[model samples]
Target: MNKKKIIANIVKVISWIFVLVFFYWAIKNNMLSHIYEEPDKFLRLLKQHVTIVFVSGLAAIFTAIPLGILLTRPKFRKGEWLFVNIANLGQTIPSLAILALAMGFLGIGIKAAIIALYVFSVLPILQNTIAGLDSVDKQTIDAARGMGFTPVQILWKIEMPQASFFIFAGIRTALVINIGTAALAYLIGGGGLGVWVFTGIQLFDNSFLLSGAIPITILAIAIDYLCRGLEYLVVPKGLRLARKTNG
Candidate 1:
């Protein structure tokens, strides 16, 4: 059909082909045999990894979104810069260092890992929410106010809908980051796929390393694609149409 659609189809085909090739290589080389041998243990580690990522991401979303919104309000506007810097500090610090500090205060366990992951993952969502809300058209907001809409009603009905795209983009970024970082949770005695990876490192076993790494890479990519689909669903239809037309 059209050039853009044709290019998109080609890209999609190539992506699937690549995935199939990678899996075939893994199987042919027996890179995943270790995983297959202990299917239950592998599954349990996968579950733990998924749980850590999901819980940390959920916590970040709940805290950051509301705080981001509050920062945009008149009462908190003056402190926006302060809070943004604090969030930035979290990103600037190494995740390992964060975990170490957390261990001292919160002890070494899943709790520390979750706290560290949550801290590390907050900035993207927080910044994006603020940016999205701030970017809403002034004219639209004024129009809403003129229609006798309360501030809360205007925000809920108008601003938030417009900002959903940026917010979701932030969330997608945070989730991907959290997934990668969760691999380090095993360092804190938090069980996950990282257990296999670290054990491989200790024993100098390539297969064990691949067993953990391959699944993590796959999970991250899958979750990213899932979030992309979610972005389409959550972002308003009108906004999507407008974006397409503008592009």
Candidate 2:
């Protein structure tokens, strides 16, 4: 099997192990009892959590990718360093701190929490997009130019295809981190599965904690897997094979 396949299999095995452990722990401690008893409450928080992550993640993707593309262009190259450093600075700030800062400006709400998450997520996707496009072989681009391919054609057909994997990798990493960070949004009254998590903490109820926490873990993993599927469908077959061989 290829390196990619080997790595994927290993990840799958590891994910399953964690899932089984979560279930075993849940059963042993009755951590999921509250979820069964309060199905509506659990589902409501689940929906809220999903909404927060989805909105922020989507915003990050939309904003960062285009900005990354612009920064990579010859006209914008001079300003790239400044913008990149700014994005990197977002990563330096603690997640909770960012949320709190947003709260200070916007007041306590889902909107503030989402803005913070978007800020946090932008760096990875931006960095990856820039890196991906940069890593595309210069010779290949030049060859395309020599072949009379328009700048737009070269960008869409050649550059984007080569860069897509890295872009997706960034998105997956960002969204997973976002999921974990989102749990902290509860502290700011942003409301999510974090509500249950903090409720457990305050009340010392393990059931509430596990019920809220494990689903977040599962959601992050599911998102990572979904992005992988997108990579398979959106990235070209030739690119996939080439990356596997090179990887």
lDDT of each: 0.92, 0.91
Could you tell me every candidate's TM-score relative to the true structure? 0.92, 0.93
Per-residue lDDT of model 1, residues 1-247, tens digit only: 5788789999999998998998899889998888889999999999989998999999999999999999999899999999999999789999999989888888878888888999998999999999999999999999999999999998899989999999999999999988889999999988899998998899998789889988998899999999989889988999999977665
Tell me how candidate 2 scores on lDDT: 0.91
Report the C-alpha lDDT of model 2 over 108-204, residue by residue, as the tens digit.
9899989999999999999999999999999999999999999999999999999999999999999999998899889888888999889999999
lDDT of 2 at 169: 96
Give me the runs in candidate 2 sitting further than 4 Å from their true place.
1-15
Q: RMSD (Cα, Å) of candidate 1?
A: 2.1
Residue pairs with clashing backbones, model 2 = none
